[model samples]
Target: MIKKIKKLKKIRLHREGTDTLVYGFIVIAAIALLLWRFIDSKVPFWCFTAIMGTVYCIVINFFRCPIRFFPEEDTTGLVVAPADGRVVVIEEVDEDVYFHERRIMVSIFMSLFNVHANWFPVDGKVKTVAHHDGNFHKAWLPKASEENEHADVVITTPEGTDILCRQIAGAVARRIVTYAKQGEDCYIDEHLGFIKFGSRVDVYLPLGTEICIKMGQLTTGNGTIIAKLK
Candidate 1:
């Protein structure tokens, strides 16, 4: 009963400022048809309408923000997935920004059709937030972690375990939004931020952390448990 209420309270529409784009496209489609009827008689009306309809559908789904349910039990050491997507990369890598040591890197790749909302992986205090400007490379590439523009958010657990989550911009994704701030307390599965379009998020877990998801496995933001802390 309590979980249901919490889920209902968390249900929300996509972030503000996106309505303008949705309505703008609809308006443009209307004007386009009017102009086409008067100017371009050779162009088929059905073709234009179909193209516009397809674009509108895609745009609407891209900005979808669905309500998610957090775990009802204790989440002390559990790390939930921060975004909805497929696990693309999982390996050990040297993290230079915060950990400056070897850690397990679990990467989730968000496609245009996936929900881009991000959430906190665990209950902790925000330790640091940093942004880096770099080339917008394809997010799936291994080099994109360092070469692509990204933002890093590090949160320290009550036991002093620091987990790092990074938002990476892809070739098509130009903006990365991060709501986490240094010195703020964050709860597991709580809303952290969002990525506008196709992108990727990397979570650096401490060595020997038990990873639950496998590569290519689909994950739901705030609903899927990714790992368990030591």
Candidate 2:
């Protein structure tokens, strides 16, 4: 049981955006230089530079991974939000792929402005880690949960409850990076994975779990308590 581990409050840029940031800056700089050096009008150069600069800053914000910790001491029956986003769904549905039973599915849809880093939602041992290739759909849609390219990570909590966290790819999201490994113990505050660009994360829990979030509510990954298990 991971009772009370270390806490880090500082926010840092995620390394996954390193290459993209570097290349984006270079290309933007090159274009700005050409506009300044070859074009006579200063208006176009300044306008283009400003627009690209704002876009780059937005991209940087997308990759910002904050070091957050679950504040409570006891983790039993606690389930945290796996990603920072607005809750798009909260309902009971039949989970066919794994549980095959009726379960509460809470889905969070991350937009381009939200953080893309994901965190483990509970103290548990990973039961399974699998990725499926599928179509890229708009993440907020219900069908995107299973139809989109995604990674499934099922963790068995210390209390013997199995929790499934699915990372689904949005139409703009092309990559899904999962860090959970089967049979390995995972705890809250540890990164579960990162989704490049915008995406969605769905957490499937057994029916009767007390949900702490409502639809359209904003959630902070690793910080927002999503539910309480039985």
Model 1 CA deviation exceeding 4 Å by range? 1-5, 9-12, 16-20, 40-43
Q: Tens digit of lDDT per residue, candidate 1, span 1-230? A: 01222545344458742774668687967777786777667465666777877877787777777777684567778899999999999999999877789999999999998888899888889999999999999999999999999999999988789999999999999888899999998886567888777999999999999999999999998889999999
lDDT of each: 0.85, 0.94
> Candidate 2 — which residues are off by over 4 angstroms?
none
The worst-scoring run of ten residues by lDDT in candidate 2 lies at 1-10
The positional error of residue 225 in candidate 1, measured at the CA in angstroms, is 0.7
> Model 1, residue 7: what's the lDDT?
43
Tens digits of lDDT, candidate 2, 30-118: 99999999999999999998999999999999999899878888878999999999999999999988889999999999999999999
